[model samples]
Target: MKPSGTASAHSDTFARDHLPPAGQWPELVFDLPELLYPDRLNCGYELLDRTAERFGDDRPAFRSPDGGVWSYGELRDRVDRIAHVLTDDLGVVPGNRVLLRGPTTPWLAACWLAVMKAGAVAVTVLAQQRPTELATICLLARVGHALCDIRSVEDLLKAQVPGLRVTAFGGGAPDDLTQLAAARPGPYRAVDTAADDVALIAFTSGTTGRPKGCMHVHRDVLAIADTFAHHVLRPGPDDVFTGSPPLGFTFGLGGLVIFPLRAGASSLLLEQAGPKQLLPALAAHRVSVLFTAPTAYRLMLDELDGHDLSALRRCVSAGENLPAATWQSWHERTGLRIINGIGATELLHIFISAADEAIRPGTTGTPVPGWQARVVDSDGEELPDGEPGLLAVRGPVGCRYLADERQSQYVRHGWNITGDTYVREPDGYFRYVARADDMIISSGYNIAGPEVEEALLRHPDVVEAAVVGRADELRGQIVAAYVVLREGAEQSADSLCAHVKSELAPHKCPRAIEFLPSLPRTATGKLQRFLLRTSPDPHGRVALE
Candidate 1:
């Protein structure tokens, strides 16, 4: 057997070549032998093939909003056909990075499994991204092939990077995976991949630069399901899952796809799921499980008077802090205690969470059964309970940023330092403090100010732009941007905000945009972010230069 440090000379070897050095990686722990996976593991085989084998094909696997559903047997057959299409038609082999762009749909889910099953890395990009954003991802991941929904063809075409071969699916385009899969005959054999083989490269917006790629392996996929979903969530086969988060977002990926499928259950896919649509869909599909951010829950609170969500057995909230008031308000409206937890794209899914019986309001519950978490000081020493410090976690899964130096900063002495400040209580619960960096956490979404600035700069009118988090009473923080327009530019705040929204995700849009003739800068012309942030509040500006 090859050691962990050696690379395999396989067709899909981009991820292996970009992994962090073995010594710099966060120390991985598999203290629990029962949950330990074999050295060679294929998550696609374990999550889908094994589930179908044991459940006897009776349970529903996935259902779409348009009244379409597939049983385990049907899903298995379809997945194999798609896997054959990826290999035989697209020439995809083990370890290749495949970019997927589209809304959350059954076909998208199938493509994800198909790519993994064929021993390739799945890179899911949001359909809302503009061509420029899409292009950046293509370059960063060195994506060999792409699969996009027909609706996204225009953007996909515009984001063309050399060497990226894109195939369109859904809406029956000539190059669709659906058509290809239909023509293929398959009960294709799954690829034999090691447990540490990279299966996904989830991107998180960068605070100081372009978006960063977080690599996760085959075992990391099962570890999330085995530890958190198994011990905390405990969803049964009869459970039906539904949510609003995009499949590109790890929070949504775990909530909507991995968790349910791991439990031998099903998920309801929706294109758009604001409160108005989510409530009725819940009643229509008899959704038993719900996953969304605190923002959505807050919006749905006022409309709860008439919604029939009695069928919902569990509601999981993440992507932001679950305030006690929000928790109390939710419990007051519906008799369900919201399952709140914290997870990052880097870690793949939730590692700290508490379910109904064990949940404590206002606190993110203790570490999951298979993980260890603690508060640490600047020197990386553990802090006593009740002292706010950096949150460091070590478990079956840890951060593996693709070839980024930030990996060193994130992982210190074998522990993953999630850049959040927290205080562990004497009773073993963890209380949220604030983000350890300059990141803006708004409406349960992480918004990097520099990324917003980069998006703002994409507009022709903007010459200089600086973004920062403004304190907010409800959403925690809002993106507040200061911009300097180019000569003869007359862009309104709303129009400029819209331009940013078009370039980036909706959550990253600037809520308060102020037009300034000039911005504070260092002697070397670097942005003086501290001055913009040192104001008395979101409304106050620092002493002008």
Candidate 2:
């Protein structure tokens, strides 16, 4: 499909100008009728105001643990007020980038919607980001204005982004955004933005080097909901959604905000949603649809003894590969089949997944409705079934990095090359092997780190494990395991290595083992294998000499 030829609604054309060259763009397939959107579409209005109009205004939209519930009408009103403040008070122009830094809350969500409603692009960064990271994002996105939570303002201010205007919120000061928004006590009209206009720029998590900004359009936002949520998740209006991801991540934005609102469902937004807090919150809020990582599901299993999970209906897992053992263990306990998916920051949300009876325990399901995916070799040619290769996807949405050279590397031959190795079964299910960079080559033998990690997790005493390749003199690379054992378990390194040897091939067994209290994980609960691979600590290290 060609780029939209309609006139743009943005006054500042930086985002549109910085988009990848038209020739380099991936082939976008909009086979589904719902994927076709009108030229003038403001996602904020479509998700919030339109939803409130369809569902009764009094229907709940957002909920807090403190019993605070914002009806769809109230949320629409708040978003309009904030939008007014952005345009009238802050002097923000259409297409200008606005930084949003804060924990997951209704107010933070409102700021995001307000930015879109005002026709400015949102650059939502995680609240846990430090000053250096904040500076990098601001510089890359060319952000000028920010709406930060009062508590998280220190780092953003410390970053000293040049010529940046900062607005504080959640503080009761006169200059706080809440006070300014209250002064404009009326409805505000949303910007008439082109469907292809950039609505947000999501920066990569920087797992390796510097982050790349992924630019997504307003239509891309609605497409995720219409395709994935409509066809796969199949959520109902009465369902209450909740998750552990911060809104900064696309996974969280889709699961908590876009999906629920598009479905006319309510969501419980939590600022602190670890496994410990998730157990009680699930029951207390009567959460029906749960979105989190595989590790959290494993941890929640240990605490499920007293929790009433009858209200929990749908569970979705992404971010990292979901081991089959985790899936079976979770299903054995809760009677719910976790929807496993694979998505990337380049793509706005999940493009491949399965739910309910269609789920294959070990596979990452199939291409989502309206999307097409397959495994391809280094030359971008499709690989035969059962051969591990690069995973490529193309649909209504694909990677569009803003003014970045990496855009060519991510999209080639009209396919978004996700940096993960996968195998397509003859039955059409895609099984994950490992990240292309995370594969360990020991004595010329290809070993997927996730397979080793999955083997370790199956041990009764093992609570968590992360496998990586350590440089060795004799062997090209040795498989090393970092494990966290169950409390009070006295499993020695020799015993754990023997267990792994029994489960996997002798060559795949971990030559070195290091026990730790917990695995290093990102704020979103993704295991940080890069840290394990780079750690210089040698104390207490055990090896199969």
Best candidate, TM-score: 2
Cα lDDT of model 2 by residue, 1-545, tens digit = 65789888999999999999998899999999888889899999999989998988999999997879999999999999999999999999999999998999999999999998999999999999999999999999999999999999999999999999999999999999999999996798999999999999999876665789999999999999999999999998999999999999999999999999999999999999999999899999999999999999999999998988889999999999999999999999999999999988899889889998899988999999999999999999999999999999999998999899988999999999999999999999999999999999999999999999999999999999988999988998998888899999995888888888899998898888888998887666677788888996434456665
Give the backbone clash total of model 1: 2
Q: Judge candidate 1 against the unseen true structure and give its global Cα lDDT, from 0 to 1.
A: 0.82
Error at 383, model 1, angstroms: 1.1
Root-mean-square deviation (CA) per prediction: 9.8, 1.1
Worst 10 residues of 2 by lDDT: 536-545
Q: For model 1, how does the per-residue alpha-carbon lDDT over 1-545 read when each residue is reduced to its tens digit? A: 11264234246578988988888888777777647677778888888899988876878999988899988888888899999998898899898999988888888888898887888999998887788988888888988799889897789888878888988888776667888899999687788888888999998733334678999988888889888898899999889999988888887888888989889999999887877889999999999999987657866775787778989999998876676666887898898999999888889878888987789987889999899999999899999999878999989888888889889999997899998888899999998765676578898997766567766765767766788888879789878888888768885776786787687888888877777887774211235566777655434232211
Residue ranges of candidate 1 with Cα displaced over 4 Å:
1-9, 205-209, 438-545
